[model samples]
Target: MDNTTLVDNANVVATPNGVLPLAASVELVCSSRTFVPFLFVFCAIYHFLAPLYTTPKQLSWILTTVASATMTLVSIPFVWDYVSSGGDVKSVRTLSSLTYATTRMFQAYLVSDLIMGSIYYRNQLMLLTGWFHHILYVFIVQICIKRAWTQIFCLCALMELPTFLLAISCLYPRLRSNVAFAVTFFLTRILLHLIWCISYLIPSNRTHTTGGSILPSVMLAGVFPLHAIWFKGCVKGFIKRRKENRALAPQAVTVDAVALAHATIPSSTSDSYISFRSASHNHPARKDYSLSTLHHIGYRLWPARKAIYSFVGLGRQTSS
Candidate 1:
């Protein structure tokens, strides 16, 4: 019985598949043995940058940053070794390419599974919180990314896009207040999903075929169009609300001014015109008082009250 394994850190053999094939050479180099270091380094960088948003505590930030940075440093050598291995897939020759490939792929899939599976675990959490919406949003993003039509470069850009958007919202006070900024964020996110779904539906290269997992891809595809409908509704609502507010705002301001005028007008005035003149201080009848009439009244009578008290033999009292 011939066994399959890597030899001399290069080449894979099926025991009976001939003394290692040249076509498998690239596969051997790319397998788990060589890929781990790079994968770990990439994961480390991600974790380091991960605490950037969700967590607000300083301690979590510091710990995650330090841990990720250290792991990243340690992963570098493993990456360099894999790179130098010269694309060989022999069990004993270069390194066990199969072992490395299998391990890393499993690790990646495991992480994905845990994340995807946990979404609907609790109904209460789903119904009452924004977490579900955000999770769905993320799912929409992933479906788009994994779609056949998406470019690898756009996937990279998508990964960085959230971080940048979060930073803009947090750092720039004006972005928080900006309706345009909010619309941009929503549209771009939808656009990403649309591009990904379209990419899957229409592959860039003619030779590529759908892997036949219709259920998952289709579900992901549906989200974008649904999102488009939702986005339109939001735009309509915003416009309607803005128009209503503009119509009501002037009336509200006028009502407020009228209320203020009524409150400040003296209740003792006998004539409406005289009262208006006194309150506004615009007419010549109120030339001596103006807006500081209350102040003038107090200043004029303050010293007379003191003199009257003094003549009554009342001594001045002081607080310690």
Candidate 2:
């Protein structure tokens, strides 16, 4: 860490060698606007490339890829440095250029995901934790930055290692390693998270936790159930997708070029009927409306005469 200077009443340290001030990263990310938009653009590009995956699944995978890569990258180094340096010099206020940048990136990613996920997973979204968890995470991370709990923030980010491993397995089943995913999941989310919630038992290490004492305990303890719920969802999704692929292997895809165009029919007097946009998709299609878009439009038009086009031999099974 470099010599700390009181700049704007916030501790400022020289870059590359010293601690990077939290305010600087936040300002760089917030004021420039391009920093966060680039993240969103990255997801958009991934969505374009991953045509085989379903809408929600593509979005989910995109976020997981970026997050797991960023969080794990920053966290491993922090943990290694602290452990190797004998841990005597490390402090709660020790913010790294990489860690703060990571935290800010995470904050921006969550915010962008809230907008994008709400659109894709809006109706099917969980009131419990699907999008709400993102909101809560943004808050907790903000608190970590505000309080300068850099080390605790790094550890909390490390807990996502399990999610990332499973995500890789899902993205590429040919390279799937359930054993590695399970070990990391249990070690990080189950064991390490539980340890964080109970760290108060060790008075010496208790102070190292963010929020002094109560908040870290309460936040992660409360978050344990969420981890269980989400983990179960991920497992079910993985298994279901595997079974789907197996079933799809023997079948043949049927495609058709039917005349279809965008339309806007009035639903209510308030003019809520907007254009039902159709875009190119990977799966077989009946004209412009592919299976996925068909599903989307059907979802958009609930109960009020759903567009059920029974194209013969299309063989529809939703893929993730």
Candidate 3:
């Protein structure tokens, strides 16, 4: 019986199936194990270099830009094929040669950035979703490397392209005031991820063996809903900011109009204008004693006087 079992196992192993052989699997695992120490060393070097940046924000922006450039360059071929094939997963090519090395390097950057971000902004880092995302990503990449799922990994990495823009929006305060960043974020991070999960990952999991593709599919499935929630928040925030800007538009226009009015004052009133401006600047405290200030003070005191009268009446009634 033992001999029969051994022979059957040997036949299964020798079969020219698409699955990796045991020796190849072991080698891949060993390579992954060896690569982890290098990743740690790189992260350590990045941490030590953090002091070179003037501010934490600058360091974050620089790291994000570097990571974005690396991933964008490496995943371009995969992205092109995916798009050209009309979003067909089968059309996507696996990473190879320099591209594979670049992808690995980008992953190292992600890990290092996460570690450094946590160290520098420990409090704010806890409030961000990125901490969990980065932790999950490291595990996902390790799994993809071990299973040789380079195409799927590339698809996943492509999400970082929009993330680069998101980082840019954070770096440039002006970008945050518009809807462009939010729209791009929704399209790339939320919409693309949703499509990938529904069209590619789910279908692949259904057709492929559990050993090769299940973990990645499951991980993506678990992450998709979170992205959906984040997208909803982004939409709401965009609307809120738009409303705020609109509300402030009139106030800004009024200020501009007042400045124009002041500029158009006749030359004959130059002396009066100069005296007014000098008094306003030199005696700011005295300028607060205006009709508007008095009106506001009266409005506040009215409520207090009513409360005091009510309290005195209640006290007299209780004593009687």
Candidate 4:
């Protein structure tokens, strides 16, 4: 037979092999036809209330909270089953009610969020990453539902737990929440996801009975690195902030030291003041002062010199 005929025959042969029946059953109960209208209604309500929010971030918080909560509810039961089954690949290959609901809800949220983001925060969409992710997720979920790959989609959905935490951190800006989010993201989105994908793609598991395909594996492999890169950026940002705070702390101490020296200089004719005069007379040129004398003078004269130089510099800067 020719290529097309062979492909057609294979599909026809595969129809009775359980996937077709499951796909039909999932469609009958959880049809996209049923989902699209609900999505539209939710979007309408969101849009009507959008003006109530003072900022785009507030609106995002509400939407992300809804998505996160739904996914969390779905993931709890799904995860329990997977673990209880001893990480059996077959456990994830079958679609449960929980998985179906999670998939549909997430797809709907992505569609609504995409529209809301485009309309309210068009600049963010221009960044391409957020826009691409929403579109890609929606497309992937739709394909999975239609093709009886709901179990695989649920495996992907596990990443949403961390995504929810990330949204919480963004909305609240708490150090604890951000730390939790980062750790959860690393565990779920990076480590567990990598393990799951590897298990799914094992050569022994690629049989027709397993319903495995290269496309899902390739898509997941591509996503894994992107997630890693994003997590690395989060780590780098945290480190940068810490370094900035540390640098600022020393400068603050130096400023306080300078202020104290200035206060004390006018009150007393101390040894430091005498030393400054003796060194100035001996050196003549300020530049020619010896290292030891400079150090001695700086120990007492630094605060006064810093304050005077700062005042002079400020005056010059303001005048210019």
Full-model lDDT for every candidate:
0.41, 0.61, 0.60, 0.65
lDDT of 3: 0.60
Model 4 local distance difference test score: 0.65
lDDT of 2 by residue, 234-261 (tens): 6786798889966754342222222222
* TM-score sort, best first: 4, 3, 2, 1
| lDDT winner, 1 or 4 | 4
Q: For residues 98-194, what per-residue lDDT tens digits would candidate 1 score against the true structure?
A: 3333234333332332232243222222332234444554444344333432222122123223324434445333554436534554744575455
Stretches of candidate 3 exceeding 4 Å from the true structure: 1-53, 97-103, 172-177, 201-214, 264-320
- RMSD in Å for candidate 2, one decimal? 17.8
Task: Give the lDDT ranking, best first.
Answer: 4, 2, 3, 1
Candidate 4 residue pairs in clash (backbone atoms < 3 Å)? none
Task: Please give, for residues 1-320, the per-residue lDDT of candidate 3 as tens digits.
Answer: 22212223433222334455566654555557655664776666656655765666655665676677567667778889889999876667665454445546656766777777777755445434667766777777766665666567676677776667776666565665346656766777777777776655555543542333556667677887777787788788879987997787656645533443344222333443454355345433332344664354334323234334553564224555
Query: What range of 10 consecutive residues in model 1 has the weakest lDDT sum?
Result: 87-96
Better of 1 and 3 by TM-score: 3
**In model 3, what are the clashing residue pairs, if there are any?**
none
Predicted model with the maximum TM-score: 4
Error of 1 at 166 (Å): 6.9
Listed per model in order, the count of residue pairs whose N, CA or C atoms clash below 3 Å is 26, 0, 0, 0
Shift in Å, residue 91, candidate 2: 6.8
Model 4 CA lDDT for position 158: 70
Cα RMSD for candidates in order: 15.7, 17.8, 16.9, 14.1
